[model samples]
Target: MASTPGILTHWPWEPLGNFKYVLVAPFAVHSLYLFAVGAEDWNLTYLLTFPFMLWRMIHNQLWISYSRYRTAKGNNLIVDRSIDFEQVDRERNWDDQILLMGILFYAVHWGVDVVAKIPFWRADGLLLTFLIHIGPVEFLYYWFHRALHHHYLYSRYHSHHHSSIVTEPITSVIHPFGEHIVYFILFAIPMVITALITRTGSIVSVSIYVTYIDLMNNMGHCNFEVIPKWAFTVFPPLKYLMYTPSFHSLHHTQFRTNYSLFMPFYDYIYGTMDKSTDTLYETSLKKPEDVPEAVHLTHLTTPESVYQLRLGFAGLASKPLTSKWYLWLMWPVTLWSMISAWIYGRTFIIERNTFKKIKAQSWVVPRYRIHYRLQWQREAINKLIEEAILEAEEKGIKVMSLGLLNQGEHFNRNGEIYLERHPKLKMKVIDGSSLAVAVVLNSIPVGTSQVLFRGCLSKVAYSVVSALCHKGIQVTSIKKAEYEKLKKSLTTQDSSNLALSEKGYNQKVWLVGEDLTEIEQSKASKGTIMIPFSQFPPKKTRKDCFYLNTPSLVAPKSFGNLHACENWLPRRVISAWRVAGIVHALEGWNVHECGDRVFDVDKIWEASLQHGFRPSGLIPA
Candidate 1:
């Protein structure tokens, strides 16, 4: 909203919320009904409104996805400012304009067709729209847009749009209802004049005109200067006819200039254009991709997880990955991504973040967790991991962490195979098992004497058991094989604290992993707590018992530009494994934490605290 919003600032159907789409139904149904019954020569121009409206919605969403992907990559970015949840919340209403547009299009089509029949195509009519748009629509919007910048209007209207100093493609359409009402009126001039006066308007021309407006609006606000310099150099006059992303960016940075709607002709003619527009455009185009100090190598968890990536829908990425029924509608694209991962396979950058002095990035392995679990897929998966390591080696990333199943014992032997393959590598490869063990051990409730350890043992499980035993805590396991495995790994002093017991129901605290069974959890007495030491979280079936998140901690406030959650973790919380990579880079550690080697648990825990990572949901018993 504006600093001081005025009348009609909210959409006319604002009170209706999402149900506002119900208003468009009657017009749409009426048009379809007449066409189906052949009740008089139908105005196909009006009838085509439904699909074109749908097309416009999709067009806007595509721009949103592209803009997010480009900005996350950090190349060709016109604005380097951070965008948080506040900006997301504020601009979420960009779709309201599309809703308003649907209502108007349906109403106008129905009204005009009632007076006289309309054609389906007219090339001349489309040309007229283009000409009128340049002559009157552009000229009028230039003045009207400038007028909105005046004190009275800016406070009550334009300020709402200008709130986003860093713009996304959708940011161009965010405005008070009063502002959109005027914008629609101006945009409708070309359509209305060509149809009513010239009598040459057709369904195709009207749709194309509106599409041109949407394209220009989304392009100018995409926050990247993608228009190549070579094109402008070839045809100098094109600069006056078309405005680039950086040109409009200057208007937001320096208010009261560059007020042209889409074309720079008026801004150039009236001298409202910013002097730095060309310089800003050139600089933004030349900006290179940043090289980070550390990288966390992660991967897609499920088939549906493609949309959960930072490059996917912003609304979904800001929260934890979850199944949405609507996602089923995207089966074609989802299938394509799965196939493309095999064909065009490579580790790709997901997002970038800064922690104090160290710059970090999160790179994805392009495969899902299900792929890692299959024995047949092991060789292929390892090759991808190896390629990613060599790529990071090429980039001089100080430390790279293997997250989730990327470091699975069965897949790559906790990322040990890479070190054996390339023993002389400079960059440190961390499985993060040490810090993960620390997170699980410290996460146990205080004063707990004995706890049941469940599930299959991994590198983390072995380390966690030793650390617990060293603290004189009783470690009991239900599976004899898992218990014996831990016993052999433990030292004589630590082994004394390890026990094989079937009395798991007696233990109140349950440290669990992959082989954790529902039957075992059910046997445990009510209120038994389970803390995951494994990368994968155990299924939660018992309601009475408390379940802690996988080994992770909340980051310090200094972790800036971080808005999206890490996988299933909550906002601002990070898994211990991923956090270990950043700590390694910050401390400039040269040692590798892969294979069977263990870092000092106490030392790793202390270093984690010193660097400002707090425990998540770890409460005293």
Candidate 2:
């Protein structure tokens, strides 16, 4: 919002909230209705309008993903600032401007007969659109933008946009309702005149022009220096006509300068261009990628998990990620990501964070769980993990923790293969089993005498069950084989409390893992709590039951600038596996906890607590 809210401060359809699109639905349907009933060839003009609007939306989304991917690399970043949840929430309404444009366009098409009669092609009108845009549209927008920077208008309107000092591509369109109305009028000038005076406008020309605007708008705010200096040198005057992301970035940093829209001609002529634009651009382009002291190596889960990445949508990434109905519409991009990952066949940095003096990064292996499950693909998956470890070691990373399926006991003996292969390596490899055990054991509510342990058992489960039985808490298992297998690992005193029976149905607490059956879950009473020892969470089977999150703890305030969640965990709450790597790096630990090696869960829990990572109670709701 602005410093002092003004008239028409909100969109007329603001009350509709997420349903604001309903306002444009009728016009969209009417456009389709005309096409469906076999209207005249020229009447198809209205039908094309809706698809053009949709294309604009897809164009903005691509710019968003591309900008995030580039900036996450840490090189060529224009600003050394962060984007928090507040900025994401503020900019989420970027599509509202597109919705407003749709309304105004449908109104014009309905009122003007000439718009309906416009032909499929008009060479003269396209030429006029170019001339008129450079003449009236660009020049007028320059002054209009300048006027908005005046204290009064700036406080009431433009301040909302400057809220994001470190801009994303969508920041170009995040303006108040009144500001968008004026911008719509300025952009409409070329088309309106092309229709009224020359009467030679076509849907193709209009689409081409709007697409040009979207391209320039998205490009200007990417917060990276993609436009190379060589381009300006190759064609000198192009610099005068076009602007780079770093050029516009200066305006946000040092306000009251570089007020031109897409072209910098007006800024130069009016002497409003920032002097440091070129220097900033050159330096940003030359900046190096950051080197982290610790790296958490993990793999992708379900295909929908792609959007849950910090590089994806901010709102979705900031919360505990779950499958959404609308994600089905993003299948094209999902399929592309899968194909690209398969072809690229290597790890890529997706997230970055700071822990005091230590820099940490989360690198993804690009392969999903199903890929690792295939007998033929295990070797390839191991190869990817091996490459990532070598790369981290070469970069002087002190610690690397294998997370999720990347550390499967069957595949690599919990990341033990890398250690055996590289005997004298300085970097320590850990599977974080100690922390996982600590989080799970501490998470069980106090005074709970018995817990029904279900699902596939693993090393972490064995450690947790032993500790539980020793604590005088009764441990019960429904599977007799699992019970006997666990009993063999425990001393007689501890094993005395471990029981095997079909008594699981009467228990209120359950410690679950992979392949937990639906029938087993269905037998549990309502309001039962399901705690998972595995990195992957169980599917929510009963609405009444409580499903705790995977092992994770809340990050400290010192670990600032976190704008996204870790897998299914909420914002700033990191997985224990990831925290273990950082703690190991920070404390200068030189031990490996994998294969037959053991960890003191009590010691790890104490060390992590001392580092300010508080144990987060795992209830999602």
Candidate 3:
């Protein structure tokens, strides 16, 4: 699903409008029943129970409708998240559900003739009903709910409820009829047991208890926080007693914790409370605008790696060993993913915002499995990237960085094609390698004597080495021919007192090459740093070694227990930082000549037939 909509201050009516009249339908029926039969006769109290069932349905529907409406407007009480509108559209059968519920509820109530009057003022029946309902119902439901999560039961029945990962109120009741039957028995058990044991027949007491349970159930699935942070702060002990919207949301999302019915006390007692529950709850309450914007970045991911992540996710959904048949069944899904990856693929926004309220939204450019196949489909992929850029621009994103390989090479080669196609779009597109080089330079410590610049043959690498050498820092390279060319350029240009060499001058090693297996093998200790141009991680890497990885289409494999790259940096974040760097780099350029970034300006002009126009000082040879 896309990101949740901007929070609306006013009450939302779209989702609520679906149930506005439905909620009152039961009340109309209740009114008719009361009008037909006067309160003078207590003998027919059994029939009046159907009206009680109707009232319960109405109240639950109201909570569901209101919660959904609020969440859709982004006025969610807790988490800033949303489900696909498609899920809501597909599950728009609540009218049918309510009719079925009404029939089932009437049958259950009619079959049981246990008559009980209102016990609003009566202490004995009210207290007894509360005790019985809370104790036995909670105990029984907890085990029953946990059992429903078992693989066998879950595949057959419970997965229906789990279908709504981001749930609404009706989602609580969207279960199999068999599970519903089990719940009905559980519900009736407490009331019937309480009535017989106390020798009391107060229908009002049972109604109140049922209403309270229904309210909590709907609230749990509401997907909006109804409890304020201050309540938990002031009380301090209320979290143990009450289940917040976030508390129940974890059950739907993480699928393990917060399994109690009305109270979380049972979850706590059973040691099943999610470890991050409190923190996640409070974090979800923060305003979306308060988070920092993330600059999303991405490169090509191997199909094998992508498939592995898919399999891991599938395993999480089903048991692994016995579910090999399930895996075989998923070949069609995997094939479809391959086909989709060749077309639209998955483009997503990071669900959570940063601390500074910056959300990093991402766009994935589609490609094939192998490199040659990707090359053959380059034009198609470029079209997808262009489409992604246009879409991001429409969504108010000012700039988006291209990935390093396919799209990156395309932009570096035929940037004019993009400019010619989308002439009116204001969104800036850049390859981002220039900014990445600048960031690496700034990160290197001040007093380093000699630095190895691997992969110096490429224009980006050559540009970086030139800049560093011009700054009077010694730079070395492995590629002899490129190193000799750079040495000639520095000597002829009369750059600042430079210590440029062909090889063997390494005091600190900076591995800038796409292939790092050679450097990884040669480096002994202290000075090895990895600035990968591809998605591969450093081999036998140390924890202290510096590694800079741009967010890519495929995540890099983690080395041992350490993460070698800045894996969390988003593509938009890279764009934001790159824009900032361009503003800094523009200082040496002719101010009156252009306002756009050098590479961005290059797209509009065809200065050189072979290498294209190079902005002066920004990409000096």
TM-scores, one per candidate: 0.92, 0.92, 0.44
Q: State, as a TM-score between 0 and 1, how close model 1 is to the true structure.
A: 0.92
Backbone clashes in model 1: 0
- Quote the lDDT for 236 in model 2: 96
514-553 per-residue lDDT for model 2 (tens digits) = 6777778888888888999988887777777888878888
Candidate 1 lDDT, 207-237, residue by residue in tens:
7888899999999998888899999999999
lDDT of 3 by residue, 1-621 (tens): 112112221123236644444544664466456657765533334455446655665676566446633543343455454443344443444444444444554554446544333233455777877777668878899899999888767767777678777776767776655676678778777566656656553656666766777777787777666678899889987887678888888898888778888778889999999988888777767634221122233433554333322112321211111223444655775677667665654453222222112233333444533642445666665666566666666766544545444334333251445656777766555554444444445445667656766552444455557667767776766566756676766655534433445445345546466555544435524545555433233343445555654312211121011111122232122222223213322222221111122343222222111111121111100
Query: By TM-score, is 2 or 3 better?
Result: 2
CA deviation > 4 Å runs, candidate 2: 329-340, 504-508, 522-528, 542-545, 618-621
- Quality of model 1 by C-alpha lDDT: 0.85
Model with the higher lDDT, candidate 2 or 3 = 2
Model 3, runs deviating above 4 Å: 1-78, 81-300, 304-336, 343-358, 368-373, 410-417, 456-459, 484-491, 494-506, 523-621
lDDT of each candidate versus the true structure: 0.85, 0.86, 0.51
Model 1 spans with C-alpha error above 4 angstroms: 12-43, 114-117, 524-526, 618-621
Candidate with maximal lDDT = 2
What's the lDDT of the predicted structure labeled candidate 3?
0.51
